[model samples]
Target: MNRRDVLAAGLLLPAILGADTGQERSTFRIGLTPVFLDDQVEFLKRWRQYLERRLEAPVQFVQRASYREVTELVLHGELDVAWLCGYPYALNADRLRLLAVPLVEGRPLYRSYILVWDEDLTSRSLTDLEGRIFAFSDPLSNSGHLFPQYVLSMLDLRPEEFFRRTFFTWSHRHVVEAVAVGLAQAGAVDGFVWEMLNRLHPEITRRTRVIERSPEFAFPPLVTSIHLAPDRYALLARVFLGMHADAQGRDLLTELGLSGFAKGDRSDYDEILFMAEELQRA
Candidate 1:
């Protein structure tokens, strides 16, 4: 109901949904980070169908409201593969292997956007929004929470000390809705999600304006437990890298607003790793 309640419920969600408990699974499990799931349920269904056919294996979708739950599943081996933001991937870099990275506008980079009500021209910057109720998408999200917190740290301020109150909406769309409908005075959300929403739901997006944008960083990537077999990993990588060339896969990518997938390595996320370190120090 409130920020504390929302956080408590989010922490308990995996258990509430009877999430997998580090058990070995036979099916090819693909866990979504839950950013796009709430917005594109039908598109996800179609994408899953394409993956199932290409992988030639039974695929199951594992999801949770917050990235934390799904990250835990991937770390514990409950999920064979997962789509996670750069922040979480860097947080558990030792335990996860890069699978593929989405190419947005033919580049494996995206930004974090600070959003405020469109008519509120008075608050054009982060400092201007001090003491305002702010919404973050998720604690483990790069665009939603980490980058904004980093911004505050740079200002020599902590979130609790800067904002009147801050809350996690658990999803980027919720962050958009909260600011759009005036539940929150300002919010931080993924730039990609914000743009997609602007295109798909202008009625709601019309109410918000981007007050600031963080520098570009590596996009969220598909990942797997480090223990996944090398051969299986190769197969999965091949499928993703070739998706843009395959007719069915290309169509799915179009529906998903993706250019294609590119092979990603640890070096691609060095900036995110640095941000993680900075946040820890803050």
Candidate 2:
């Protein structure tokens, strides 16, 4: 199946398998975006089973198209928890509790990448693509949207005036696709996502080259609604934090190209908050 088919199947899987069977169990809902999980149908199934087994409750994975949608759901109590970009989490920190952050290369940090077609070796910076089409993953994306915007603000170049045209693919993977297929001359994407795709789908990534890298920022995190029951919240946190210690969890982390999950603090996203504030005042 293609990416769209896989995503559609993933969206419906929760409802089909999470049906009530007259058991006195409450479903624990977790929201996800297609940013990294666009084609991870099997992984989602396995991860859900793993969480359900550990949490000793029904677990449901709710997939959405963008970070803003998932963030809204979590903030409104439609989701118990969500693995979200640091941008949205920082924006709504008061309404959400930091549950965990994924560890990449043993640290809960990642960067943003500015990319162009691989053969375009002449371009060295964002300024080089000043008059070309650009793809942004999502408006609420720190790496894909905010970072690029911040860079432009520093240069005193507004996106509308700098780029010939700009668009949102809504998925980091698609941003890579846009650049690869010439839909976009350049794009801003999550460095971690780009690396993961390089490992899992090199054919696509090989067509693109990383022209620039931003300073490291805290990796995206799993967050819970502040109103979640304390006991349930603790269980969710324990399962994620202990993933590295368990054999199965360790295997899952390996597949995801992550070291494990860490008990991250709200302060971990201070840099992102600063960027957001600076952009707001610009």
Candidate 3:
């Protein structure tokens, strides 16, 4: 599996949310979830290039359609690294390695917003969408699907058993746009992505309002192939965790709107693993 296969494969799955890192290889190819259009993705390529210069290696930014594809890339060794959501990380933890991740507003967590069209009739709880069409950012998204579904299960309601229909928007911005455009009655989106989108395209995202927010979640983290050497993995992690203190690295963080990078561990994804397992058994 290479870059082409990664993008060719549709990736609609549950994913954990949170973070990025400075992990690198001599000639690394990495993937980012296709939440951004091409132009916005090009803007992110600069971050990979900056890390390349510091690591003294060439880095290729692989364009991928889904977090599941990114996870598959790492697992298959087609991609040396990835910045994937948390649920996907848990799903493929056996084939991946954690490098480093972002710390936002001094924490390593991110949030998910349960959203609805401004024109939607009164409803305050998750169950309000029951028997109605619902949209999720991606199948692998934490709050978007995994946690939200997990919440529904906690309430003795399953999405497939409750909602009339459920669709995957594939991107956080799409979740906002879908609900706003009335393509979906309601959905879950990354809280940070919602803020970013609203800031970037106010008229569009503003048409929708957040009806609820899930408990705080860890943002996507930079993960690598399980095959990567421990020394290289440690070096990669160090470069990222130290980014906030370095001039060029700090600039990259500023561009991504992240405060800095931080150390992370497997404990970071325990809940993701738990929910995934719970869902499978049900």
Q: Tell me the whole-model lDDT of each prediction, alpha carbons only.
A: 0.87, 0.93, 0.79
Instruction: For candidate 2, write residues 1-282 as lDDT tens digits.
Output: 999999999788867998554333468899999876789999989999999999889889999998989999999989989999999999999999999999997999999999999889899988899889999999999999999999999888899999999999999999999999989999999999999999989999999999999999999999999999899899999999999999999999999889999989999899999989998898
Q: Estimate TM-scores for all models.
A: 0.89, 0.91, 0.85
TM-score of 3: 0.85
Give the C-alpha lDDT of model 3: 0.79
Q: Clashes in each model (backbone N, CA, C under 3 Å)?
A: 0, 0, 17
lDDT of 3 at 167: 92
Off by over 4 Å in 2: 1-25
Q: Distance from true position, residue 262, model 3, in Å?
A: 1.0
- Residue 35: error of model 3 in Å? 2.6
Better of 2 and 3 by TM-score: 2
lDDT of each residue in 18-44, candidate 1, tens digit only = 975433344678888667557677877
The reply for model 3, stretches above 4 Å from the true place, is: 1-25, 36-38
lDDT of 2: 0.93
